[model samples]
Target: MSDFIEQLSPLHTVEREEITKAFREVFALSAGKRVLFWMLEQAAIYQDAFAGEATNSTNYTLGRQSAGRRLIEMLDAVDPRFYPALLIAIADLKTIDLAAAESLAKQQEGEEYDVEA
Candidate 1:
């Protein structure tokens, strides 16, 4: 047997330290629970695919869309504790602009001040 072939094993057991730190910084207890629950749910989908109980394409695609929607909904409200993780996840998300978000927040703050005047 080839050396490379012998190494066929389970997924890499890498510790998600950075991601965990990001999670701690971005979410409160309830939000963190939601994130972890979603993670486990998605992992189960992967497990099903690996076991041939689910299709590769359909389940993966649907799972990803579901996860993304849930994450977006969780992040839609401005919670400072969770904003950093959202920013990290959205770093490469071209559809959402951080600068625009900041500007809109500033505008809203200005409106609130004006209302009080």
Candidate 2:
């Protein structure tokens, strides 16, 4: 549909097949890959929006935060290999502190606060 295409055009750069392959390679899908797939796509969508022409600063910041949140969500659901890649990507979006992810996990586990850099 034209409306659907128009809405999605700015939020996607990679082709569908490429994205599918990326999902397969990164997620390995059997072990909680669905959530990873969803989060990765969400992050990509936000990045795409931020990268689009005529995009405003507000939209860019919103998209970056959306991507960051999705990456954080993926940290909980995805593989260990995913974490550092996500940290870099999140940092590229201007979010600092990969340790926040670890801290959040520890907080959830009711562990004593030991913030690592």
Candidate 3:
């Protein structure tokens, strides 16, 4: 649990139910939707982390390359607890592709399974 999560406890009963509904809907989404959900969350997280940083053309390219590598590392890890990851995944009957009521599965090809400045 986090202080941030605890802060959400102030929500009214209806609000809490709505939040749970969000999870339920997300759980019902398909693979592509699940991918987009996590991707958008990552975009928001990165934007918050570096919204004011200065950068040059050369460094921007290098930074993009680094981000790609790290993204692959994360996807391969198959664990949301990895440092830079979606806080929770939407679960379905088969498996929770990305935090829902189902189990978390491995990569599509196999059951095989980080961050920096």
Candidate 4:
């Protein structure tokens, strides 16, 4: 009994419960949402590692291509329906402009409300 308990005690029960809870949260999300968030996180990592002052260099291009290939491989493991949404989300993330987004938000705040229209 002691040996059996020791063999299974690598992760304490509390740690296992925490891991189970994290998995449940991930499982609760729609497949598309999961893929979108995963791709966005991957993109940020790639940008930080490869899209710096040498972004236009050949090495950067190669690194970006490799990261894109890995992203596609990851997407292939999930439902096909999520592919388009994930692609669009990643593209939008890549092209997003913070300044333009802030300006647009400010412009909308000054607009009159037109719920009936």
Task: Give the Å shift of residue 39 in candidate 2.
Answer: 2.1
> Global lDDT of each model?
0.54, 0.55, 0.46, 0.57
Best by lDDT: 4
- Model 1, 1-117: lDDT tens digits are 357535645342123334445655545454554465456456452343342555766577666757655655544433344545545544434345567788899999999889854
User: Would you give me the overall lDDT of model 4?
Assistant: 0.57
Candidate 4 error regions (>4 Å): 1-56, 88-117
Tens-place lDDT digits, model 2, residues 1-117: 557546665447246446546654755443334455455555554354554565686586677668767665545443455655554454543343456776787787775445455
Per-residue accuracy of model 4 over 1-117 as CA lDDT, tens digit each: 567546676568567557546544543466544554675555553454554577576575676557766655555443344456555655665456566788788778766453357
Clashing pairs in 1: 26-81, 26-82
Candidate 3 at 29: error in angstroms? Answer: 1.5
Candidate 3 ranges with C-alpha deviation above 4 Å: 1-11, 35-117
Among these predictions, the greatest TM-score belongs to: 4
1 against 3, candidate with superior lDDT: 1
For candidate 3, write residues 1-117 as lDDT tens digits: 356556665556467567456544543456544564566445443343343455564466556556655654544343444333332433342264233322333233244421233
TM-score of candidate 4 on Cα atoms, chains taken together: 0.33
C-alpha positional error of residue 96 in candidate 4 after TM-score superposition, expressed in Å:
13
Worst 10 residues of 3 by lDDT: 97-106
